[model samples]
Structure formats: C-alpha cells, structure tokens
Target: MSASGLPMRLRVPSDARFRPILLTMARRVAESVGFSAADAAAVGQELAARTDAVTRKAPLAETTPIDVTFDVANTNGAVFRVRARCGGSDLEVTRPLPLA
Candidate 1:
C-alpha cells in the first residue's frame, strides 16, 4: 500500500529479458478462458517453444524489439497488446483477451 493506504500496482515494461514472465501471464490468461490447466500449460509451452525457435532461426539484426502489455479491467474485457518498433517504423497491434 502507498502512504495513502491504497493498494499499490506494479508495471513491467515488455523487453527481451522479461519473456519468461510474459509466458506465465499468457498461461494464466488461457486458464481463465475456461481452458483446463493441462491445456493452458500446453499452450504456454508451445508459445515459449515457438519464441525460442524464432529467436534461434532469425538473425538478430532482422528482428525487432517488441513490447507486450496486459490490460485488465472489471468493466472491459482484458486486452493483450503487442507492439514492435523496428526498421525505422513503429508497429502497434492490440488483441482482445477474455477471462472466464
């Protein structure tokens, strides 16, 4: 809590070093969408695996640094936004995420 006694919230900027944390968040989202734990785990596994494959197969210079954001709200459905800025241009994309 802050000095005012309100709950504190934390923010994490999406970066290469935070991939593992993002993977966990994705898994939790999957589970909340009515997927069984096992299924959610599988999805998370595949997400990580695919990310690894891309990193290994692509040249570093050809890849762009991307950011991920998880926006959770009571009145609005969750939103997972991924943005990549590279090649002298900024690309922003947003996806709707559901919580069961």
Candidate 2:
C-alpha cells in the first residue's frame, strides 16, 4: 500500500471484465486518502461511470493496453485525480476530498 494516498499506475488489458478490479482499487485508494467508507464507494462508482463514458466515446480493442493512473500523492490538495488512457483516448476525472 502506498502511504501517499494511493499513487498507482496500472497497465491492464482493455477488457470490461477488469472493471471490477479497477473499481475496487479506486475505492481502496479513496479510503487511504481519508475518505469515509461511503465516500470511497461513491468514488468507485464515479470512476466506473467515467471509465464507461470514455470507452463508449472511443472504443478500444480488447487486447489493447489501458493505462490508468491515480494521483492522490498531494493529500494536501483539494482534489484527487484519476486518469485513464486507451486507444489514443484520454479521460481524466477529479473529485473533491474531505478536508483534514
């Protein structure tokens, strides 16, 4: 586990089957960044929706590699960011974090 509130870079096959794993990781990262359980769950849901939207707009081959990066290292910052890139399409989502 990263002490810097979930700084992760993942390269996974662009398959819908991997969504659950991604979502789980997102939620865990959120929790590590001081989000309540409910908030973490919401983060996961939002991440999933954003990912789906990105894929829908620019579809990728199942075997294509998707790069997902979670940037929560700036725990003092006001927002957390998640970025996903696949098939030349990029999606970035930012969510506000609870104040310390």
lDDT of residue 83 for candidate 2: 83
Candidate 1, residues 18-65, lDDT tens digits: the string is 557646765676565445777666656665555545455544442355
Question: Which residue runs of candidate 2 sit more than 4 Å off their true CA positions?
Answer: 1-6, 73-76
Q: 61-100, model 2: which lDDT tens digit per residue?
A: 8877778888764555667777888888787767887788
Q: Top TM-score: which candidate number?
A: 2
Give the worst 10-residue stretch by lDDT in candidate 2. Answer: 1-10
lDDT of 1 at 93: 33
Spell out the clash pairs found in candidate 1: none
